[model samples]
Target: MNIFDNDSEVLQIGALTIENGTDSVILSGDVEITKTQAGKAQAQALLDFAQALCAVFDELDSQGLPATADKDPSKVVMVNNPFE
Candidate 1:
């Protein structure tokens, strides 16, 4: 599978799973190489992309974006709306 973000570039290229009673996620791209070589190269590229994404998430978590906030019971509020 190949995933592209809004920038419209090759963001991730990876192998897809196909099994019984399952639908495959088709990727739109030209598979212009030998199966073995293309699979190896794309797999490596996708791994690199995944690592980069993980780093970004880690950075965001470190910045304290309310993800680590304590669960206070008093912060919970209930609102009732009867309009149907």
Candidate 2:
């Protein structure tokens, strides 16, 4: 059988998707925010997700891939705060 054919195995796997070019972030599955531990875990999970994008492009650059030199896409330095 293929991997993850059992329901119990599926529960242990989580997927996170992030798109640096479009400024998008996603967390896999439903999140429970009632507990402080759960909330912090979810937030940290997202932060780690964004960081993973840098390695992808860095690998491409190491391979001599042509990329725009005008901007540093991996560094998420400033965020637009609407409440400010």
Tell me, by lDDT, which candidate is best: 1
**lDDT at 63, model 1:** 77
Kindly report the root-mean-square deviation of model 2 from the true structure over all alpha carbons: 13.1
lDDT of 1 at 72: 85
C-alpha local distance difference test of each model: 0.48, 0.46
Per-model TM-score on C-alpha atoms: 0.40, 0.35
For 1-84, candidate 1 gives per-residue lDDT tens digits of 222223333333433321211112224444333479777786676566567656755775697645454778998998888784
Model 2: colliding residue pairs: none
RMSD (Å) of each candidate, 1 decimal: 11.2, 13.1
After aligning candidate 2 to the native by TM-score, how far in Å is the CA of 45 from where it should be?
Answer: 0.9
